[model samples]
Target: MTPMIDVVFLLIIFFLVSSHLSRRENRMPVSLADSATGISETSPADDVFTLTMDAQARLFLNGSQLSTDVFSSRLPRDSTQTVRIRVDRSLAYEHLNRVLATLTDRGFQNVSIVTSPIAVSRP
Candidate 1:
C-alpha cells in the first residue's frame, strides 16, 4: 500500500512539471488578425488610422477626440487600408460591438485590434 502511494505521487509530480513546461513552450502571442504572421514585411502606412477606447468607454483617434460620426467619416475609402483599434481589456463587450458595427457601417473591412503581448497588471 505504501509503495503504491509513493508511485502515484511520483507520477503526479512528473505530470505536473511536464505539463507546465509544455504549456510555456506552446504559448503563442494572441493577435486579433490572422495575417499578423506577415505583418512585419508590410510597411505601416504614413496615414495609418487608429482608434482607442479607454476603460471609461471614451474613444480617441491618434490622441484626438472625435465624435463617432466624424471618425467614421475619416476612415479610408480604400478597403486595403487597415484600421487599428486599441481597447482596454475591461471595456464591456456591448460597447466594443457598437464600435465594431460603426466601423463596418463605414466600410473599414481590414480592421485589427491592438493588444499587449501579455496582460497588464491592474493598479
Candidate 2:
C-alpha cells in the first residue's frame, strides 16, 4: 500500500510539471492580428503544432527560435496535423505568405492563422 501511494503521488507531480511546461511553451510573446470574424475555437494542445512569427519576422517553433530552413525540415509531412500560426500584427504579409507556402508545399491541410478578437467600439 505504501509503494502504491508513493507511485500515485509521483505520477501526479509529473503530470503537473509537464502540463505547466507545455502551457509556457505556447505563451511566446507575439502580438496577434485582429479579426472580427475569427472564431475563438482552439484544437487540443497535443493535436496542434504552434508556430510564431514576431514583429521582426523571426520564426519560432514552440517558443524556440529557428531559421526558416530548420523550421521547414522539422515540420511533419502529415497533412492531418493541425498547425496554428500566431504572427505579430506588424509583420509584413510577404513573410506570412512565405510560411503559408511552406506549409502548403509540405501538404499541411489544417493550418490556422491565429488572431485576436477585435475590440468592439462604442461611439
Candidate 3:
C-alpha cells in the first residue's frame, strides 16, 4: 500500500511539471497582431502545429529559432495538418506572405493566421 501511494504521487508530480513545460512553448515574446473580426477561440487538439514569428521576422518552431529550409523539413508530410501562425504585429506583410506562400506551395490547406482580439475602446 505504501509503495502504491508513492508511485501515484510521483506520477502526479510528473504530469504537473510536464503540463507546465508544454504551455511554455506558446508563451514566446511575440506580440500578436490584432483583428477586430478574428475568432479568438483556440482548438485543444494535439494535431495543431504552431509557428511563431517575432518582431524581427525571425521564425521559431517549438520555441527554437529555425530557418525556412529547416522549418519546411520539419513540417509534417500530411498537408492537411492544421497549422497556426502567430506573427508579431510590427512585422511587415512581406514576412507574413513568405510564410504563407511556403505553406500554400506545399499544399497545406488548413492554415490559420493567429491574431489577438482588438481591445474595445471605452469612453
Pairwise lDDT winner, candidates 2 and 3: 2
> Which pairs of residues collide in candidate 1?
none
Query: Candidate 1 versus the native: TM-score?
Result: 0.56
Q: Write the per-residue lDDT of candidate 1 for residues 51-111, one digit (tens) a residue.
A: 7777767677646666766867777788667776767777787888988998787677778
TM-score of 2: 0.87
Worst 10 residues of 3 by lDDT: 38-47
TM-score ranking of the models: 2, 3, 1
Task: Give all TM-scores, in the order shown.
Answer: 0.56, 0.87, 0.83
Q: Write the per-residue lDDT of candidate 2 for residues 1-123, one digit (tens) a residue.
A: 999999999999999988997786567888887887867656678788888899999998867899988999999767799998889999999999999999998888888988888788878
The clash number for model 2 is 0
True lDDT of residue 88, candidate 2: 92
Error of 3 at 1 (Å): 3.0
- Highest lDDT: give the candidate number: 2
- Candidate 3 off by > 4 Å: 119-123
Q: Candidate 1: what lDDT? A: 0.65
lDDT of each prediction vs. the true structure? 0.65, 0.87, 0.86
Total clashing pairs in model 1: 0
Residue 34 Cα positional deviation in candidate 1, in Å, after optimal superposition: 16
